[model samples]
Target: MNCDQRAIRFNCLGSSMIGIIDLPERPLPRGVLVVAGQPDSRLGAQRQFAMLARALARRGFAVMRFDRRGVGDSEGCDYNDSDVRAAVQEFCQQVPGVREVVLLAPGSGSAIATASACARIDPRVRALLLLDPRRRANAARTAHMLAPPVPAPAPIGAALFWRRSQPPRRGPSSGARLAGLAEQLCAFPGQVLVVAATSAWAGPTPAQAEVRQLRALVERAGTSNRVQIIDDAAPAPADRAAGGRLDGDALRAATCASWMVSW
Candidate 1:
């Protein structure tokens, strides 16, 4: 499979945001949206996002990555739902071959991805691939980074695609945000694949503690989902390090490919 890339721009709030898309000669209707956490550009740690996008594209998915508001080429003061929603919209609009989408959120960004998909912010979003899902270690930092979405809308069923973007409130405590995410996730209708990164070599546990929580919540959602635990050759790094310099990139890639085919 061969892949190519292009630049794309969209509007979030009053600001203009930019992203990159990896295109395959022939693409599946389901695309991928790679959400980079706030203060991090789409380039991801050491440009690993760039590498991942191309890899997914080669696997026959239309893949995309972009800057958060106020980061990279995007223009905005901070992160918000509108940023993720806008990116979702752009992904669907730009990739004519893509109908539904899957989100791949590496770390804290998993919080954002869960909010968007589980909350039903966009109808096109169908599944999630979360890598080492974990919350921020610092509560105050989490407050500074995340903004809570508006009260969720009633389930619209067939009306989902025509729904409008929900409003948002900025700077909530991590505890508050986590509680909200828990509630929404239990209602999410899509399948979730959580990649729990840990191992004896990884020096903690082969299964992450957060992975257990995530699985429990997802199972309660009443949807069929899967959890795949792969051993890390070394202790897992923070989101930044994991994204950029992990020696287990090939393993992650293989896992993604396998799950996607099974999906």
Candidate 2:
């Protein structure tokens, strides 16, 4: 039988955050809470988040997906320490028999999840599944470097040259941040799965570089076994050629589902 799912509204910092809870007929001892980053609601892009939640629920796991403070039907600005904490509390209270919680965070939400898990901020949080965890952009640093104290007078008829000034190049800071997060999570007493998706569209992608850097950091932390890389090489040739391209989202969902079931 299909699980019972209901829309929920949870109060956070005096505002409401919209969410949905999926409870299996016979629930597992663990529950999952999906935390998405900015610009993505609980549904996720192309409804991938909803699909993954339904899939997991069918596999006998209790699942909850919610919007952050301000996105979707939620109220208030998305700036507060109570985002993940409130959601976890609501999930635990609503789900009757879950003994532990697993946070499934994608994109920049991974950083939030890692910080919470490492700090043991919530005792119920037991594991993390981070997919394509985005590196935090150093906007202040970029702005500082790009905007010089004084601009030299543009040469006569050189307006185009001035317009083409590119922003300052980013250094290894993003990699360093990832390394720090991985180390913290490794020290925590819970399983952490760092998943990297290398391709997005049918062209050269930038996430590949990030994945390499993150993988190196995990290896340096002596936790390379904990990271899972889903790229061109992992899929079978037939799967890759099914539609003359690989479905990155499908691969990611399958990898996550398989790992969670085993965990």
Candidate 3:
């Protein structure tokens, strides 16, 4: 599998932002754009994504993975919802012969993918692959600050009741945004794949309940959506040492069914 990496500039948020492109040995029908999360630059740490990109390329798919805004070789400030969405839009438009786009995002990058899908009305985005969907830590912090603190529910029943009784919150609600994105994708007349990571941060076991809950939530939100959960064992010693590099297999699995995979 031959792979070539290059840097280019794409229009994002009305400015030229730098990005990296991973080209395959053979020409591909569709190009996959992988968007990285949080600490940005996945250039070196994204071995799994890199491997999958090469694998997909060998399978006749062109793949591209880039740093968000202020990360890596990109020129711009930090990224937000708008910035991410715009970047995806620009990449989709700039990449030649991109028949379809498969968004592969890990952790908070899922939120960025959702936002981009919601904002762009292109039918080329055939599928969205969310690996380890997580509520943005910043959003959670804001929610906590805005929400009235409950004085430790007196009992389990009370806690449940309190949770049920509260009116469903709305507005730039992260859950709502995610649901909106899912709805949009389902409405796209294409396929959607959601992969949930089953392991918790501190444990060596898969969180079956968590994966089930996430699947149910997506199913309930979009009846036509297709969701899958792959329960991986706790990261091996090598993966633990590599940090986010462990996500390659999950990403490749999610993208294999779509036109191209990106994470």
Candidate 4:
């Protein structure tokens, strides 16, 4: 079926956030608001998310994806903790006839989704779909970048160069902060689906400690939860050249998950 997509700007907490709404030619079953990763506008607006949104629309879901504050066409300088919460709150409130909300997030956006859910006293959020979340690792990277550099003796020219070349160091790791935020979100009442990339960071399997922490949090939340890890098997040459579009089976699985709840 042909999908109808519209781009619009809406005011949220005194800022204009840009978004695209996709509707199926037929009636929709429910509405989903997708949150994108850090530095990514509305599901990366990439082929993967766009294809997923279009697929959901075909399966009777009205999907909306937007640029977070300070990203893309959205108005803002930077997104802080509170702005993330406000953006989600506004997105939840603005979508019309949304019976249920599936907070879909990827990468760093997962923490934002969790925080937003935790901050809400309202019962609009029904489920969460976290695709390849990197809460701890992302936080760690951020902290490393922000951490203060140690001073060392150097020649005048060397010292000047070091001052310009050294990266800022901030206290506490982003991963640690995200863990705290995740704990808060787990307290909220909702189902969660975690999709983890097996080849995440092009490294070895996920750290046991990280996996254990995530599992414990999900269990403690008392919410319906499932974790799916993508395999790293190489595709056939023909398929590989096709740019890794999700297979039919993957598409079906995501659609089922997206529409799991009743409005």
Candidate 5:
């Protein structure tokens, strides 16, 4: 099926922002705004964003992928949540009869989306699909990693243990940042889908605290159903048959779209 893709230029704070809208021949009531992380264009690495837009359009949705100010063809010197809001508004205008809008952000874009959602900048944004939201270990967590594991009990005699001599160069503390991000995301009055790459999933790592906090906050807010997690580990054969491509990302995007379609 052929979808109409149009290159659009819109004004934002006296600067021009460029975006592409994929309009399905037979539109649905939903629209999706695909936000790129810092330093990534709308096309995304390996054209994952483009592929995602096409996939969503094939499923009868209005999808928009755009470059933030100062990136790609957009004219500006900075990028921020305001720029994302501008893009979302532009996307909504291009897709007629869209009753709901979903914000899909991969990587660091998750932070931006979370900020926007917490602020409730746009009421039309009904959900968030965060594919690999940025997560990193904090200084304390790093120290813990460098610390030696506790000795096993006498009954468990085969446990191996090792310790590093010294802690390496310390990175900035990320606990506060990650905690704030999670809080903001949970504050959103809509659904949130967090899709993490197994390679980076925090569930069983030093960064698990932040992920756990997010889940706890969501549950406390009484919107546990509003948050979902997808651990994308081994890529499906179909996704990998494309050769050296970022098939995992494409698969994640497709799965997200399908989930939204059923919503």
Candidate 6:
């Protein structure tokens, strides 16, 4: 499906904000409203947001990306909760088919602030997409000024673990325990083989990137021992037979058993 892109303007507290809406031939009820950031505006760093909007629109989703105060054609030097509400209102009004919206904040620079502002967003905003939450840098200074306070942190994602002869536990451990375990592994008088899982699904996930980071950290920490990865996906091929789960499970078991027996 083809997407049509057009510029738009909206008023928030008497200031004009510029934006672009990516409309698909047949749009879905759920749309993406990109929360503009500083120094990049709605285009994003290297036009990432624009490309993202177009790509999403091609897949039948309606995407709206607005500019922050300082960037693009937007006026004034500040934006607030009013701007967000106005944008959401404009987004819904522009795309009548879209009843709900998901706010996408691209970087950690303002990830927390953006999410914080929407703590009590309009009912039409169904979700928040904050990319790179691992490296949060700033908090909206005026966040407290908003009527309802920002909700407590409700992070989503899997916890990383390190397995040993008698590992800490079978399931996810607390952050403190995880840190202590990492320190313990670095101090242990033996080799460490970090086993991180990869997906049969396409594209690079945070888990995979974290696996690489773990390997690098271990290499630096355990300077004397030989550290290696046991489940690195070297560009996994398509699941031809669609039995990726069966094959992956069998391979993981065999690899672990063989490694233990060899040791």
Clashes of each: 0, 0, 2, 9, 0, 0
lDDT tens digits, residue span 101-187, model 4: 666666454454554544364466666666555543465567847889878676688778898898986765545754664664465
lDDT for each candidate structure? 0.68, 0.71, 0.57, 0.59, 0.71, 0.60
Better of 1 and 2 by TM-score: 2
In Å, residue 143's CA in model 4 sits off its true spot by 10
TM-score of 5: 0.72
- After superposition, candidate 6 runs with Cα above 4 Å error: 135-263
TM-score of each candidate structure, all chains considered together: 0.68, 0.71, 0.59, 0.63, 0.72, 0.53
TM-score of 3: 0.59
- For candidate 2, write residues 207-236 as lDDT tens digits: 677667766766777765654444433554
lDDT of 4 at 216: 61
Per-residue lDDT of model 3, residues 193-253, tens digit only: 5554555555654346555555566577655334444454455544432444555453444
Q: List, residue by residue over 124-174, the lDDT tens digit for candidate 5.
A: 888877765543223244666788989865533333222233456765455
* Stretch of 10 with least lDDT, candidate 5: 156-165
Q: Ten residues in a row with the worst lDDT in model 6?
A: 132-141
TM-score quality measure for candidate 4: 0.63
Candidate 1 positional error at 35, Å: 0.7
Please name the candidate that would achieve the greatest TM-score relative to the true structure: 5
Note the residue pairs that clash in candidate 5. Answer: none
Evaluation by TM-score, superior candidate among 3 and 5: 5
